[model samples]
Target: MGTTYLTARLNGGEARYKLPGGHPLTGRSTPDLELTDDGRLADHLHGGRALLLDLTDDPELRALAAGYADRVDTLTADCPSRPELAAVLVRPDGFTAWAADVGAQALTSTAGLAEAPEKWFGVPAGAVTPG
Candidate 1:
């Protein structure tokens, strides 16, 4: 009840949190897996910005995240262990700051996809995106 996993505004107010299910990786440590793009995901997480460890083919989410490329390192990789996770936003300290799940029924979002970097890292320079 105390730790709200979300930072983004929902309906102009904080999102009502529910435990149990969102994405398996939400609020947990990043899994030790080798991604296709990078040999290891943990390798890229040491940088200043959070890494968007995307595991699905969600172009809209990736495109939306792309706008703030200057604020994050988007890694599109396959998670063989938990393929259900659509994406996970990994903080620099190697924790899952947010996540989005794969399909309906269990379809989910932690609301940090677009807001986490601004919450953890400072605002982007003039809302600038990657060129």
Candidate 2:
């Protein structure tokens, strides 16, 4: 079992859990693929908050993900011959919290994109609370 699994089992920390064939990117660690635009991915993977990556250079995806900028480290990269993944919300531990793979699946994933951050990291940065 992976360290996250063992730690979660032994020390009672957060566990990634089995995803049961969701997006291939979901529930997995971020790939250490080189960034075409520059910089190493590992350098930013643990940047305090979750890291939201726009890997395919999609403008809409970047704009959509930017909404969580205050809660995540939104970044763009051109990963050559990349996987089907277009965007991903990765936790500080380097595991994926949420992901939107390319092609048709992106549609389904994007629909729930708005909910991913809040699900993993609590409310939005500027969300209003009940009086």
What's the TM-score of every candidate structure? 0.62, 0.70
lDDT of 1 at 131: 79
- Model 2, position 88: C-alpha lDDT score: 71
Which candidate has the top score in lDDT? 2
Q: Look at candidate 1 and tell me the lDDT of residue 21.
A: 35
Off-target runs (Cα >4 Å) in candidate 1 are: 1-21, 104-112, 122-131
**What is candidate 1's lDDT per residue for 81-103, written digit by digit as tens?**
67666777777766777777776
**Model 2 CA deviation exceeding 4 Å by range:** 1-16, 19-21, 105-111, 129-131
lDDT of 2 by residue, 1-131 (tens): 69778887785345455642366667776667677766777878655778878876777766655656777888888766676667777778777767766764454244466667767777665678678
Q: Residue 14 error for model 2, in Å? A: 16
User: Candidate 1 clashing pairs?
Assistant: none
- Each prediction's whole-model lDDT (CA): 0.65, 0.68
Model 2, position 17, has a per-residue lDDT of 53
